[model samples]
Target chain A: MLWNLPGIHVPADPLYPGAPPFLTNTFLLTIVGSILIIALMLFVGRNPKQVPGKLQNLVEWVFEQFLNLCEQVAGPERGRKFFPWVLTIFLFVLFANWWEVIPGIETIGFKSTDTALSPACAHVGSQGFLLFGQYSNCITPFFRPPSTDLNFTIALSIVTVVMTQVYGFVVLGFRLQIGRYLVFNQGIMGFIVGLFELLLEAMRLISLSFRLFGNLFAGDVLLVVISFISIGVGAIPFYFLEIFVGFIQAFVFAFLTLLFFTLGTTPHGHEAHEEEHLAETAHAEHERVASALAGAKLEEAHAQ
Target chain B: MAEHEPHNTQNSRGGGSNPYQGALVAFSLVGQVGLMISLGALLGVFAGLFVDSKLHTTPIATIIGLLLGLAAGIYGVFRLISTFRKAG
Candidate 1:
């Protein structure tokens, strides 16, 4: 069953004319997603029971897992400080990305006669859907995943990087944090190194934003292509894959946020101490593995 | 069998880290290292071009920027790998 798919466009389609250029499908979804998240959190948290219901149980489970992770990664004090920011990012991105799998997200839209935007024929197919054989290419979807939009991802990344810098200054104070980027005390090579550090920070922003955008956009295209090739059945596997991708991307984003927060807040002297701690941890792990292996060997010899 | 207790307390996993944490860190770092190098070079080239426009030294600044960016990216990769190595 061949279906005419809309031309895959990089930019999000505006929902209506004269509604301001920023009122694209992705923007609409962003607002809706934010409200949904806030409402869900409030409803679940408003009345707490000694014994939680299914909804509350799920919410609490997610929170506990992430809270543990934050504490483990950034230590108790800083992790507690950074928990809310990390959790908010994880939840928002997770839901926003999960929107892709919803039925009629890209399919349900008005057939536009605007030839400039949608040049295909406006005629609906006999099946009564706008995206029929020749008519499918012109439908402007009312809902698109916010993650697929560069604007949304870039804006989110800007917030993340800026907040990281803010945390750095807050925790490390002006002199130490500013010294990270501008090393005037040392000679020209140190100055050059500082410039490189500044450039690397810019690179972090670009990488963070584009990594998310590229993955989600590619996943969106993959789903469309798979569906186009093998009706609906072939798309099932891809749907599951997309779901997994959505979760993973959200997780990676959150983890990166937490990491950046940790790095930004940590002073240079503290970083050296952390490295020493890490070395100690590695040494301990090696000893534990060696002992386990030795015990396993002894058991095998005894059995033989 | 005794019923498992709910982990109501933090750091109650007997000092054992989350299994998924290592995997995720590795996954993210793989993407991160490659991206840092490529984007570093790209940012360098763009900055060079901008300077070239003002200074009227077209290719010279661009070349210098490209080299510096490449070096910075390599340094960054090494730094990341060392950190990972120590942690592991």
Candidate 2:
């Protein structure tokens, strides 16, 4: 089942040509998805609407949702500024996500070499890869969801992490960004904690990248497994569940990016108002002690 | 969303010229896949443990499955990273 499944090949043909191992059926979907998104947006918003019809209205709604999401997850200030990025990401991701259901990815590709880049054994199966070229020319699945491809998801994740860091610097500045993990005030304790924070910063790159990939890839594998395990009716519910998961995973990725952006840009000590109060109290105590000692000396001199 | 229009025009090389940007994007894609596999392996281990308890064996079976899953996930991550480095 695993060998005959949808994404077993990177070249799907490993040999048909001197193809790179990175190319696969799943990647075909991602490439098409990106194009589809661009095309859809161009077609839908070609004209500015005063009142707006159904498609226009829907596009506007999604746009509004992404903006609000940015504001909610990021502050209103950054949200307004980053709205473009968040919206583009969501739209591109959403399109990539829903593309698999478009009906051509599985049964529509051409019969090439059946490796990771290809699907099903070319010579043995019933017309392997039906819709495109011999090995992934511009002729593969007219549409494959980008998210299904591990490579595509990882690509998206990496960009997202980079964007987050870029925005962090924009808001915090370089010195402040470094200060977030290089504090020297608390002496050795601060140094240790700072090192931990730095490590976490590096870990964020891995964690963010993997979380999205994990969800999307798992969904893809689940669908393949379910389809293979039971075809007539048993797989129906799982398919529906996969649809729900696809949307949720996309939402989670964008939302988390919003979250990381907010957290990353914020100054560290700003949250600890109580510490400032304590310092003020200590200063007042020193002043009171000094005044009392001066008063005592004056009293002793007068008495003498 | 409207802001995207301006940026798109700026980035529209339209010919896949920005190899560096492409490499970063490709690296990210690999990260996500490795993560998914790692997660899947973790879940598999958990499932194996649940079944193992009934069979009177300890967590050995689950641990083995988990280790295998981790190996696969890590292998995927390395593959993606190496590719990114080569392309870069």
Most accurate candidate by lDDT:
1
lDDT of 2 by residue, A10-106 (tens): 2222212454675655666556767878888898879868998898888876776666555544556886777887677766777777665544455
RMSD of each: 7.6, 14.9
Return the TM-scores of chain A for each candidate in numbered order.
0.84, 0.73
For each candidate, report its DockQ versus the true two-chain complex.
Answer: 0.39, 0.04
> How does chain B score by TM in each prediction?
0.76, 0.50
lDDT of each: 0.81, 0.59
Which ranges in model 1 have alpha carbons more than 4 Å from their true place? Answer: A116-131, A269-304, B1-10, B13-16, B53-58, B78-88
Model 1 lDDT tens row, A177-230 = 898788887788778877877776777788878888999999999988888778
User: In model 2, which regions exceed 4 Å deviation?
Assistant: A1-16, A21-23, A112-144, A270-304, B1-88
